[model samples]
Target chain A: MSHSVDTWIMALLTLCVFSFLYRDNPFYRFAEHLFVGAAAGYLLAVQYQNVLVPNMIRPLGRGNLLPLVPLALGIMLLGRLAEKTSSASRWALAFYVGIYSGIAVPAYMQAQIFAQLADATKPWQPGWGAINSALILIGFLTVLAYFFFSAPHRGLHGASARVGIWFLMVAFGASFGYTVMARVSLLIARVQFLLRDWLGVLPGA
Target chain B: MDEALDVRWFDPNRINLLVGLSLFILFLFVNLRRARRAPSGLYIRTLPALQALDEAIGRATEMGRPVLYLPGLGDMSEVGTLAAVTISSRVARRVADMGCGLLVPCYDPVVAVLIDSATREAYTQAGRLDSYRSGTVQYVAAAQFAYVAAVTGLMLRERPAANVYMGSWYAESLFLAETGNETGAIQIAGCDQVTQLPFFVCSCDYTLLGEELYAASAYLGREPVQLATITAQDWAKILAAIVVVAAVVATFFGYTDIDKLLKTS
Candidate 1:
């Protein structure tokens, strides 16, 4: 067994969380609440040190006025706390949304649309590659058809859209399988930590 | 031979992108004008998940249990969060109209404020301002698993009849969904996160996949400008498809011009 106090506390919390698999209980609730409260406190401290201190406080202390713009915007965001000043928060929200949208639109167009189209339109090699290329083209077109809201799915469009659904389901299945494997790996890691690090039962430990 | 690297203020290679964006704007403007002239003539296909939203809320109202909504763990910068906020506004409005209890637990403080504002507006719009509760939208935690823990705890304790999750999600999607499932809540989840879609699909009653999440506001709002945006997006997709086909055809014929033209860098 581990003699370290931190290890003991962590191992117990892990067990408390695992208890939820059987059913929700006081131990699990205690662990959950503790984690949430600790996390919220930790986040506040980290943000103060990492973000507010360096970006706003330190800069202002150094007589840099540029940071004041963002600082003012942030304060305005806090105006939502009171009903009388709540509408004032919209200016900050609008600025944030507008800047983000302007940046995202061009980036999305370039990366998602243009880059993807460029790759999809690349020349195929020979033989089997050509067949794979054809499949890609068909899948792309059919999926696009499925997402076409303006057009009603009927006849040829409906068939293509149906095929698109099949493609989507296959994708979802593959993703689900991949994610399950990842979760299993995580579970194995936790089990290893419990057995080796805590109990010192594993060969290396 | 020595050659100088031609560097300019702007890369000419991205001209194609500029042209495409211009066309998109043109389509949006034209569609907006058309939609304003005749909003009723436009047709948008029914999204089953969005359609089920009302049904989910109604079930919660009938069961006399609060409807829980979690706008996933994303800040305002994310488009998914914005879309989620829009849908949450609609949900709040409906909940107010039906005189049902509503709960919205938030991950981001900024998003909490946004949701609080939206919910208050929704209640006011529905003439149920008195029903608006101060603590309806609460900021739980910034950490992902911590937020999930708080939310799952709430779900178990409150036993909300309908659980609505919208926006960007991560690994906690399943944790939230499965816990809600255990509580026997009618779950309707929508997200743009590709990896979390399967979890929602398996656990929730209805799942909005990919672009469907983005389209929900436009579909539900049915306002002329919003519907026009949907139509414009369709047109943009059509244009992209045409370009892809043209480039492929051109490439098949040993002409690499179209391919090179589309390249970003």
Candidate 2:
């Protein structure tokens, strides 16, 4: 088997993370802190290179004034560091939230609402497919009815919402199952690494 | 003038979308205006999970321990952040009145500031401004695992009696809840994440499902604008159901025009 500094470090970090299953300890804390510090440092460098230098500094350097609007907002955001000046952050927050809400309105309406409705309205094909289409329609309506709290869920609304709960449970069950499978897959990969790459207990290479 | 440089304000292919958007907005405005003039006594079915929030807070107050709210680990710009802070404000108000300690460990510095201000404002509004502590709303850690580690440690050491988890969560949902459970805390969690729902459902004493999280906020706030918007959303859903049923019938008899009408570029 071959060995390298990178490989050893990888094994050590992996083991450190895995050790949390048993109990939290100094080694785990060291790895966790190191990970956070590394991430923060990387984020700082990326922000400078990708955002600050390029978007803000260069545009101003090229004699464009529009970037100043965002630069000013960024500066105002930093005002949050001090209590006396923190109120200035509200202007930035308001602008950010207002813009986001405006953009999200049309975007959400188009994609989530209209597009979904359009798809739901697809022509029902015949045979067993027709039955499936009907079920989908029922499921969609019931689930939607479940979310519709403007009308009290009683009588028909109550019945439909109950049905919706069943559908939602099924959906959640499937999602939960999928997530479990994903975690299991990760466990398998880690175990395979420990055996094959680290210990060379299996055939390969 | 290059034809290639020509920019159209409205794309012809999405005329259907333009019409749909217009109608929806018009409907929302009409409902909003009507609601403003006279609240329709908006019927929101009782959610046990939301009710549990008060009970959980009360339990912490009774136990003489802090109530911890972990608003998931997302960027400050997301809708979840807004929801978190909104709920945090509500909780802070209640905490001030009850004289119970509140813990809000923020992931983003910007959000830390927002929530701190929000909590302070809530405390002031409750006329208990002196009780507000800035340390409760400070940033914990930025990295996901680091945040989880720090929170887990907090749960072990602080041993909050009631833990409220909300907003958009990831893999760390269970991590926090399991740790909170070890402390024998009464936990209530809410989120729109489908995958994390199961974990919350299993671990949390009461869990608010998807869409219900937003509904809970609107319910708690009961602000006119939010109520009207929620009413519009319900109407939209009803309209969608109608459309779905009609389209299914139309298609069963062989209709293609509806499909074409919805197509976009």
Best candidate according to TM-score: 1
DockQ of 1: 0.72
- Clash-forming residue pairs, model 1: none
Tens digits of per-residue lDDT, candidate 1, B1-265, equal: 8698877867787888899899989999999999999998777889898888889889998999999999999887787898999988999999999999999999998889888888999999999999898899999999999998889889988999999999999999999999999999999999888899999999999998878888888888899988888899999988888988987888778887776778887
The number of the candidate with the highest DockQ is: 1
lDDT comparing candidate 2 with the true structure: 0.81
DockQ, each predicted model: 0.72, 0.55
Looking at model 1 chain A, report the run of 10 residues with the lowest lDDT sum. Answer: A116-125
- The digit string of per-residue lDDT tens for model 2 on A77-185 reads 8887797998898899888778876776666566666777777778776688989878888899899988887878899988999999999888878887888798899
The lDDT of each candidate is 0.90, 0.81
Model 1 CA deviation exceeding 4 Å by range: B1-13
Candidate 2, residue A172: the lDDT equals 78
Question: Which residue pairs clash in candidate 2?
Answer: none
